[model samples]
Target: MRRTRITAAIAAITVATAALTACGGGTATGNGGNKNPKTLTYWASNQGKNLDDDKQKLTPELQKFEKQTGIHVKLEVVGWPDLLNRILTAASSGQGPDVLNIGNTWSASLQATGALLPFDDGNLGAIGGKQRFVASALGSTGAAGKDPAAVPLYSLAYGLYYNKKLFKDAGIANPPATWSELIADGKKLTGGGKYGLAIEGANNAENIHHAYIFAKQHGGDFFDASGNPTFTSPGAVAGVKQFVDFMASDKITAAGDAEYAQNQSLEDFAKGKAGMLLWQAAGVQLAQRGMKADDWGIAPVPVQSGAPGQGTQVDTMVAGINLAVFKNTQNRDGALKFVKFMTSDEEQKILNGKYGSIPPVTSAQSDPQFSNPEQTVLRQGLAKSAVALPQVAKESQFEDVVGPALKDLFADAAAGRPVTEDSVRKRLEKAQQQMAG
Candidate 1:
């Protein structure tokens, strides 16, 4: 089982949103009060440095919205997992915010909540909608391909970070260009209480991502033609094998590798206890704090040992925050106006730059902050080479099912009794059926 790694850096955004207080009304910035005092309640997920610390960019925008519209705005930031519960709790009681940020993958799930506004042509036009965002983001946010249910906020993707010094010391002149080389280098770097690769073996979502990239290398798809789960294919089996084998193989993973989580793996690599790992672009900054850039370098995930296509898992750390006038909020126009301001190109520029995120809008990619070499490559991958996780309503259940299964597989493999390809395929096939049913 491959663990799908969720970046916890976003936790602050989701956690701070639990606080929502006061609401008031305001006039349109230009026009006279279209209505009485308009109060807009805006909820956002956590952003960088500190949730409160990052408010300089947003509070000003809120004030601007208020001064122009004559509406007072209440701002609340929340963590990831709690965001949905808070929204549901508020919505059920008719006290939800006028706007709320949701995970991009949660777009479909939240849309099922029936509490969000659909970005129809008229509304989309108001905010420089879909056209401004990347196509993948647009695809992820839309339901039935008509229009997006949420506005794109920021974007993220995974990249390979390696210990440059380790590779040089291993008598390797160049980084791996193929998956076989990656494995070979991993083997060479093993021993001395260190690891060659730092995959999150115990994290199932991370496993799925690892499988997805490997399967794609063999021209395999996660869902069959009809969008049904088909995770038992030859390619998928092979992918899973590679993951289990890597952990089980001597010198590849640490003795406690299966027990390690995402943070553990990152710490190991940052401390030079590991050779390489797949991480979001943010890891570059984390590496700088503990290790020098010269000590670590990044590259795209390598191609399959001798397989096909550019198979890399481009992980995205984006969530679409949909703004809707609660059926009970009495301030529909004011709410819509506020959303328009936040998604506008000008504001998006500031958000993407200072927040260390990418705007869904494709145009935002051109911003200098995103123009850095690493960011530029990540943005490109999101469009041309990324594979999205299965965004089914049962996504959480899917994660639960795969997590322990992969842990068991990793343990078995590490003990030199890993599950065979044939057995893994059969087991995953049954799991897919359960998920489908």
Candidate 2:
């Protein structure tokens, strides 16, 4: 999942610094016109089971880089909770790692700060040209057809995970292929204190990702071509209502599940308390939680069937992290070298394999491991129907505003209170107003 921890306060801080002059163009020249710096610092995001795990896996790669480039390197693995705040502070102060990893969802937002070096034509050519990367992954780095501020390093896509045993017990021969069928299957599976679906209602990022998929399935988008917010569009409203109705209208999920975060929902599924869940490559976590390989199955998320002219299926957000170079670093050339090394096909294999995510490099994506039965469905969905979150400067604000509105609606639904389409529209309209301000 693309976890955007950006709160209103953080959004305000980013907005305040948006006007700062961007350090554009070529890498900074070395002292006295000499090139080749001796050292560089890299801020890596926490990708492994823990921070130490990340260090264990990356240290060897960094050593290889140092040996190849003669540049000493310092690596710091930042936890997700602190990474964004740390990057924002560094951007504003012009002090941070020479290179760093950023959530793909934040690419456009951070690019607007002028704190990162743009991977323009020259820089991209130095690495391997734009065509070397997957088109969908590259499309997420920044605004369309513009010089991207970052490059994709790893990739992930959501899948619908279900309990095979649960389906069999419910007399269902196959997983649901459409929303209506999912609800029907859910009704059959819900009973005897077990739920049919598990939702991360309290986690803002999780909620927004599902909301995005639902909106796209209904032929709606979060923003129009002109970058105007369209959260209250009929499609958006219908999508969100479908999400919230799991607790309200369907009654297939628990009323108290509005408090569920991503982990909690996963825990419920792992324990067999819930029959199905929508999650990203969580196979590692599921195994860690004591779930067996044969116990669960993965499939593409159900689409809105019978919608006029809509495609057969829609999947989750095109999710992953990107590597970016800070604009103010003195060792620009060294940092660029480091970025090239990290995204190299070899390094992509090592990092993505160890982390249980797909490599962004086209050649590396064909690895045998990625074709495991569990991942095959998700990879196919990504190739065909995975939608990237809207790449807008205000994307973070979109999360900050709509997340709580959805949360509140879920809370009310869970409490057996009244919820109407008008209420959903009002919440979305208020969010639009907030984005306008």
Candidate 3:
């Protein structure tokens, strides 16, 4: 999300910053230097059920780092709502943590600031070569042909989650494998006060993620080669309309979903009010909320007609967090050491296991813990079918603008207003024009 979700991408600030241009090479600032080799600061994105959980879980690890490297670490867990804004403030002022976790979707946008240390061969080699990371996980780190602004840490991919009991009760034998089947199954599950699908209609990140997949599945992309917005393109409009139709026309999603900016959809699915959910690595959230492993099952998010593939058949967005270093950090060596420690196979297994995410490190992914059915579905999708959001300097702004356009459309759909090709196109046209201005 901007699935770091829709809650991520960025917190909507009315006077949003303008789009930035990618910088050609590494740039440094004077605010950071080698003045504090024995200490480092980190801004970790909120990955646990709450901020305290993150701190409690990470404290032991930081202690280990301090013991091993003699570096005292300062840790701050920033909520998704404020993470990007805080990072942006730090980047522009050259006053930020030594290291930070960024929503993978923001890689290129943050890269353009030139405030992050790009992992060129030397930097990458300092930790482990770029070869140590999963190839697909590497896809969203930054723009193509440029040194990555960050490296993969905790990786995730969306999958369809369905209640096993609901499927049985409805006499549905299997989860839907295509759009038609999904809608059909949805109808069977829609009665008795239960709907077939749960969605985060007002979530910008979730909206953009699904819209990106739907667009590509219909054989289109949001940006051109030069990274220009093409939101009104036929495939994009059709894609968005397809998403809205799930509620407006198909009647699978509840009308109230149009106002669900929080994780109400997941909660709804967990409580058995909805039969299915489309989400990224939902096992943790569901488990914490009291849904056991046997209660639900997971499958690849449906494709148009056939199995998911690397091309237009893509089904999920490459969603996760990236570990990055600020270019001018005082303790560059200490920060890099911390990165290596975090991405280490042992740590990857421990950390990703705790967070219910797939390890981006190839070796760690082979651990038996991740071999479960749910992990298999998510790992396979991330490796074979998921597509990264456009890696552009304006990618963050795109989410800020286009995400709301869909939000409004979803609102209209919930209000019993018509959702049409023309309406979707007009909204997209406005979104694109905003990009231009």
Candidate 4:
């Protein structure tokens, strides 16, 4: 569900130091006792269909806030590829937005930099308190028992999307509920040169996310409670093997799929060339590409039935964006006020409805628009089984190192090489070593 396009810029210790310097070496605490602030700068993530679309959707909200609070906001919509770099640069230079949008997974990484304000109990009360947010969504903002550096603004989750026509043609009566059934159904659906599954093997971020979910379902986690990597654990090995098996052992996916990115995989599924795809709420995009509403069906991701430590089904990462206030802001009160307004019930409904995402506020989830049939399955998955990525300082490293390692494994499997448990463990172990160093 991450919309990231991998960039070469690495977030290192030096980068964190620069960000801290930019923020004046102190925790952000309400404009240093100045209660009234005039204007605030806001950096928003690009979530609309186009770059300008986000601006259009947010401009009205900004105007509304200005009218209500008498505080004007200077808005800038940043693209994903440049957003991280911009934030880092601003953090180092002490010159950035007063408030900003960040990927939920980046909360821990950015919080470690000491350049963002922590939304502790006292600060959180200003925005209608901690009770306002969905508990699961709020859980992703920081590590266990810590005050979050950000707050949930939007929510998303993964779902198993299948081509209904293809399923009927294959005589499959239902979507899979277990890994074994999924593999078997895939085999039956694969024929006439089309694949049974579409995989974003080349996209490292997408690959790592799937790896995380699969590993968790198998009773393994990428990082232990203390943030040390466990990538080579038995559960992790089993989970990664299952992903690789889609192309290797099960043969439900094509060799070229090893080169497929997220968009390409979605394209293949929409074109009816792949029977199934694991993706977020992508029905809007699918419809734009000529796939009718009735052409596809959505289900929860399958789980490993008998894997050790497997409790309830673990389906997806609590995927979405969060809003954060920068420590460097001179107008902390103004920034905090603006943030509260953005997450209010009216704003959440309008923005989330336009962006095709779920609102992060618990009260907003009850809206009838969110309960539409097209989004029902994904909503159910989020409420029932979705888990967020480990809220660790090394979260980005997990994506950077382990992601590429898994990509290499997928490449090897696509080349018809024998992918053993030993092979998977070796790659994961190498990633663990890199993270430790």
Top model by lDDT, which number?
3
lDDT of 3 by residue, 84-198 (tens): 7788776654557889999999999888767789999999999999999999889999999999999999999999999999999999999988998999999999988889899
TM-score of each: 0.76, 0.88, 0.92, 0.87
In candidate 2, what are the lDDT values of residues 240-294, reduced to their tens digit? 8888888888988887679875478888999998999888787877886899989
Count clashes in each candidate, considering only residues at least 3 apart in sequence or on different chains. 46, 0, 4, 4
lDDT of 4 by residue, 1-437 (tens): 12132221334434654555554543433222222387777889977645787898899989999999999887889976567768766665555778899989878877777677899988899888999998888988987778998999988888889999999999999989788888999999888988899998887768888998988887888887788888898999998988988998899998899987547888899999999999877776687678998999887788877322224368788888999997756677788898899899988998888776889898988899998765687777777788889898778768877878888988998998988999999999998887765
Cα lDDT listed for each candidate: 0.62, 0.80, 0.86, 0.81
User: What local lDDT does model 1 show for residue 322?
Assistant: 39
**Root-mean-square deviation of Cα positions for candidate 1 versus the true structure, in angstroms:** 7.4
Ten contiguous residues with the weakest lDDT in model 4: 1-10
- The reply for model 4, stretches above 4 Å from the true place, is 1-39, 48-53, 66-75, 306-312
Which portions of model 1 show Cα errors greater than 4 Å? 1-43, 46-77, 81-96, 255-257, 260-262, 283-289, 305-331, 391-397, 411-417
- TM-score of predicted structure 1: 0.76
Which candidate, 1 or 2, would have the higher lDDT against the true structure?
A: 2
Span of ten consecutive residues with least summed lDDT in model 1: 1-10
Ranking by TM-score: 3, 2, 4, 1
- Once superposed on the true structure, which residue ranges of model 2 sit more than 4 Å away at CA? 1-36, 70-72, 306-313
TM-score of 3: 0.92
Against the hidden true structure, what lDDT does model 2 obtain?
Answer: 0.80
Candidate 1 lDDT, tens digit per residue, 228-260?
667787777776777677776544877577876
